[model samples]
Target: MIPRHFKLLLLGAAICAPIFSSAQKIKAPLPNWQNLDLKADGQFGISTEKAYNELLKGKKHVPVVVAVLDAGVDIKHEDLKKIMWVNPKETAANTTDDDKNGYADDVHGWSFLGSAKGSIQYDNLELVRQIRLGQAKFADPKNIAPTDKEAYKAYQKMVAELQGKIDKAKESSNNMLNVALKFNSMVSKMGSRNPSKKQFADYSPEDPAETQLQKIALENWGTGDFNNFMEEEIYGAMKHYREQLDYHFNINFDSRDTVGDNYADVNERNYGTGDAAGPAPDHGSHVAGIIAAVRDNDLGIKGVADDVAIMSVRTVPNGDERDKDVANAIRYAAANGAKVINMSFGKGYSSNKTAVDDAVKFAMSKDVLIVHSAGNDGKDNDKEPGFPNKFYEDKSGEAAAWIEIGASGYIDDETLAAPFSNYGKNTVDVYAPGVKINSTMPGSKYKEQDGTSMSAPVVSGLAALIRSYYPKLTALQVKEILMKSAVKVDHKVTVKNGDGKRKVLFSDICQTGGIVNAYEALKLAATY
Candidate 1:
């Protein structure tokens, strides 16, 4: 069993100083992180010394591999380029499957969205579509087949969920329209169409036309750089707002029809095909930069691990991902010798969990570790279930090496867990910094995104840190070590309930109410 005080020691270096340089073998802390040490000379690179001695001074563990199964990585981001996993046998753009692994030109990894038919966004409104079409299809006397009881039941649940999405989408869409219209009206009096953030910030309302337009712009997008805020800056905001509208408001549009293939069909492998460089893969690029992005290159942000290789497996879409794609991506990572898998995506439904579950089991059997996001919905999830949980087995001791991570903020507790993060009593193992996190995005740009999606990779990065240094630990052991020595938080912070109200402590939200601190984990790694 894992020790319980992992979280009690999250206050600061003072509490962690006791475990320094012990003879016991345990996880190590960041020896001297240049970023964490506020009091350092002109020198750069690692800085904290005392914490390092107690953590990673003399640790012994296995070098494990992590698999990142997300939209896809840029693979070229300066910080992420060096560590991208390379396929030794496969030739790039040669039009031949050199590795004989079914994917063509899979130099880095596989892409389930490589084809057009497989590249549809998540079915945020699938339940609504099923529900709207259900009664018509089921009640139609001339229909060729009677309604499936099980399918109907499933559809019913999804439809109820659809109602929720539709309501949310409608509300957000209306709010956006209101803001846009208000801005339009304000600008109308000023005789201007659209103004940038700079213009709005510097303008005076006394100018009649200019003033109205400025007010409109300020209200709509605020006094930020409207001309350029990076793609993710606006895109991330838009995505979240739209999801709020679709999932929480009154507008209910469905678009699950675009992706024509059934997600349960493993035989349907060759579906999506495209160059990894596309408009939709912005999320993947940013995540890649965080995991293995090249460091000390005087580039953008530094990745978590050095001496790393990233595998770009494009399995996620703009919305809910299909089970088949997720499963196939896992297999691709495992087959391509991927050491780690980072999954920064999730949804509330899975039509075919068996395939994804089996693939997770397969990866664990092969000693591969899978890290995933706990999701962005701010609801207490101990009452709900998220996809890709592998802790259970069929009366056997065999369990997949899986880690479910929640989002953490710069501040501890309440603020520690990103309000949008989904939590579980025993399912989610840990949390990491995910709120307003600064990382790489698409278009050679960097921005901040908030979600458990971002939190998962940080844990994956720490896992990679352990795996890269100590390769002997199996996937399960790594998961145990991470959780066992986690910074167990006991602070009673407020949480956002489903009704969007402040509630109680975060412990009511996740399995273990603590964040994944690499520093502390390293400390345990050194002395455990």
Candidate 2:
């Protein structure tokens, strides 16, 4: 079981850190990192290209369905449209559940964030919601029963910590927005849409404010080019702040109403609409592309797997995904013949962990492998409970089909571990290339996104490849083989430690102590 102090450590680290590695610097926007050979590039990449060229040169494998439970995928994405999974039994726009599986018109996959009316865009974090619901009863410890006393204490602690985080997020958002506004005004007045530092270096501003703004821009933006500094750094920071204020820290918002389901009842089914791609499709689309963007299409980037069908399970929202939605998404994927499920979203708190556990069990029963991101808290997950984990909070074994993944960088340097990746020798199974990962975005766009969110799908894509080629391997077997076949590295590494950096053995972070390798995994699969 995770110690009580471990949970507190998670809260502290999560509050201090950004959701993804802010230290992630934009390199050449390319897709080679995810498939780079370790020996050639001095990277911890999965050797996806090598696997395709050598191990899987003449292999003809069956198509495998991979469920992506994320903020919602753009099923109509140019590179993803043809490779997306379509329910053969369900008819589109027919006003009937033709599949007879409690879902109607689930052509690509089901959307659990919506109802007949519309879809949700925002929601309260589970910690905030829990505090609000139990605040009155736990106001005074004197009235609480003995059995409920521990829970009451936990509620109080969580309330205090989460509230602090919300306050900090609000302050950060205000500061970033203010800076962004100032920069925007300065840029507009400068007359050049894409002005460079060299252009500003020669100018002398009459206004004091203009002088100050110019100085600020030169100091920060001069080091990097103007376009990159604005679009990659400042704009990215603004988006992060906006998401924090409008979604993660919003307490009064309730998206469940849009879903029109009793969130308390995990048994509730078929309460969502047909729009699998919710209001946001960027995150999920990016994830989908990492797993199975159309290969050899001369498109933006080729995915790791060639003949894989991406099942778009839209369960995640702008904020934390509810346990009910997650449970339903897993079961839906399992029932619909998905060999693997990639969950790129996770929360620190779970209101109904048992519900998710039961669903995981159901998925495992149907031989569905689950791949999850270890989170970006920069804390040890063996001690902290990242919800939807391989084991329950009580330390009881839950699912053998699950693979907990941590993010790694392409280069083999001191900053090998992605600055934001959560790791644990016992909890995380393997590491994957995540930093500055270029993949498909919504509206036929392509962008570089960094996070464990990207790493999980890299493994998911590999898992699909293995399962497709070796159809006889069970979910548990695949999980084990992936772990055992990982390219182990025996060296000390530097990882994030809240405010400071810490050096630790690579083995201390993840069980494999190395990076996931598609070539190695395929070779092992052949043996199986």
Best by TM-score: 2
Each prediction's whole-model lDDT (CA)? 0.59, 0.80
lDDT agreement of model 2 with the native: 0.80
In model 2, where do residues sit more than 4 Å from their true spots?
Answer: 1-30, 139-147, 181-193, 196-236, 393-396
Across 40-114, the per-residue lDDT of candidate 1 in tens digits comes to: 332111222323444555654443344567767776665666666777898888778877778778777766764
Error (Å) of candidate 2 at residue 471 is 1.3
Scored by lDDT, the top model is: 2
Q: Poorest 10 consecutive residues of model 1 by lDDT? A: 1-10
Please give each candidate's TM-score. 0.76, 0.88
Which digits, one per residue and each the tens of the lDDT, describe model 2 over residues 450-485? 789989999999999999999899988899889998
